[model samples]
Target: MGTDKPLIGFIGTGVMGKSMAQNLMDSGYSIAVFTRTKDKAQELLDKGAVWKESVAELANSADIIITIVGYPTDVESVYFNEGGIIENARQGTYVIDMTTSKPKLAVEIFEKAKARGISALDAPVSGGDIGAKSGKLAIMVGGEQQAFHEVKPIFNVLGENIILQGDAGAGQHTKLANQITIATNMIGVCEAIAYARKTGLNPSRVLDSITTGAAGSFSLSKLAPRMLEGDFAPGFYVKHFIKDMTIALESAEEMGLSTPGLSLSLELYQELAEKGEEDSGTQALIKLFD
Candidate 1:
């Protein structure tokens, strides 16, 4: 086919991926998409994107393939499953995986891609659903510089901050750090809210006060309102945050690091999940203390 414009295919159209793909299509890329459920692709298809039947079909048509699936296993399956991307992807095509996966998996996938003369990068993101919708996520990318530059334009359309961390698995490592920080910050915010309640202080007012002082953070400003309103809707699911935290702590363990805070948060998330709050927003972590 002709190469007038890059053929961009996106997999995983959940909360974050769907908005990201929509922004790319809005920015005028030739878009093709596939999700596990056919109906999830409907909005994009209606907006001028073509739908592919499977990962292989999507890879076949795309010059640049972007994956933003859920967990490490799902990320692996998208590229290596039956009728997956590697089965049909051609040499020299670029693949960027934006899933917050294990760094080891990024290294593994990068080696496999390099063996086939393809370029691969692990580029995970942050800034949550609002960021995804507003095209303001922070992207941490790892791969060859040339391939990063090649994809930078599309990333520019989808994110506000983009950093090339290092080699093959650096992005995933950076993402682990991100999750660790998030886990601690989330715990801190939830605990502060719980503390305020126990002390007969107006939790909302407590948040409003400290939020302007040194005790403030992005998490406090954003999630505090949700926690106060008892709105634990899945802007980002507790299950996904737990997955990220578990991956972070595991990575830390492999490096012989001490992260007691992360361990505590991980256990708390596990407890929350076991109580059927896994699908709820991570702000529901407050429920554990209540």
Candidate 2:
């Protein structure tokens, strides 16, 4: 309601959050940050973020609270626990959860926020860690229309593309759609690369050829280069993709739908996770062939 620049408090400064928070600071917003690991906060702190000691403190001290934690459970703990944001945050504060989480939990949190006269939006993102680093993710948001408008400027600073899908958990539903497509596409990319490697073709050349045709895809164009170079460092971890695929399967089951491709992707990621490559990037799925 105020015309002043919003006081922004960001929690979960992991791979994605660190860069996103830096972008916010660069955009001239006052930032307060909290992370489970204190060292993750140093970059943002050096870049001018005021560090908060806890989620509750961050919520209490700022008007806008943005969470980019790892999973549904972590998100729940941060907002529902004894020292969580809801415990100390004032009414009229805005909360945007950017975690790719369960849609049901998103709805539950949004309802609780509404009862307290606070605004909450479930806005999950695509475009991976690179997107976060560049503030160019495609954000799908779901919440009250007015609240969506109120947060548009902040979203602009965080993402290159933003869309208000619907109310409550719609943003997460959209992200599930995103994951479903990604699950299958990544599988296609893996299979193609494996085929090329087995047939003694230059996988890099194969990547270049397909990427210029209709077969071109984000996973192929963006991830194939890294795969060709044998890089498995984290941009988005294999375990996290597994988590997202698991969420997608659960959502499809609830809707009485079956996605066999995603089902297989889930299984493959589980196998990769068991191999202790959980922290590796999703492109490491190529190791399935090895």
Candidate 3:
């Protein structure tokens, strides 16, 4: 809070948020962090991030707030509740929600924040844990143009592919579209390796042949290797992926759009989650094939 740069309040120090907050601290910005679990903030505290005991405390202390919490319900609780960001943050503060949540909720936050003179942007991210650490995540933002420009430098520190898609809930809509693509892609990646192993070819050899070809994808190039090496750790969790797919599917149905691929993939991911792989990395979806 005593820094020349605007103090950054980082909420939700999870798998990706931890690395992202650390990167900001590493870039010399003072960070105030709060999560439901204090221990999760320890690594960042060791690296010079100041710890706050609650969302309201952090909200009042920082000029810019960034949150990447789990679930739409969590997002609502932090932004709309009595002692939350909307009530506690100073006038003219910038609040960025990087959580993949409901588009309607994003619009509500934007309208409410605007009335209270706070700038709120729904800026959901992609590229997983690796990108968060490397600062290469693709950020899809939606808010007023002026507000987006004001936060672009901060966005630059957190991601490479940053774009202000439109207004209010547009970022969330874009993220749902991203989830739809990834849901189908994960299935294809799983089946490719499964087919290769069943037909007596080296899965890695098959990957080498196809990774740079027409079949190339992030799941193929990055996650396939993780699957082969049996690393089911949460780069991105199966539960979260299923959450995204569910949001995408609901949005599609609302628009009278048909997404058979998204529907099937959601079914597969739901099956994977029900099998007790919810906390595992989405790459573990391949286990369904096995």
The residue pairs that clash in candidate 1, if any, are: none
The per-model lDDT (C-alpha) reads: 0.90, 0.91, 0.93
User: In candidate 2, what residue range of length 10 has the lowest lDDT sum?
Assistant: 81-90
What ranking emerges by lDDT with the best candidate at the front?
3, 2, 1
Where does candidate 3 stray beyond 4 Å? 1-3
In the range 189-270, model 1's lDDT, one tens digit per residue, is 9888888999999998898799999987778998889888989988789999989988988889898999999999999999
Candidate 2 lDDT: 0.91
Cα displacement (Å) at residue 200, model 1: 2.4
Among these predictions, the greatest lDDT belongs to 3
> Would you list the clashing residue pairs of candidate 2?
none
Reference-based TM-score, model 1: 0.96
Better of 1 and 2 by lDDT: 2
Q: Write the per-residue lDDT of candidate 3 for residues 187-233, one digit (tens) a residue.
A: 99999899999999999999999999998988999999999999999
Residues 64-122, candidate 2, lDDT per residue (tens digit)? 99999998999999999998877777999999999999999999999988888899999
lDDT of 1 at 54: 81
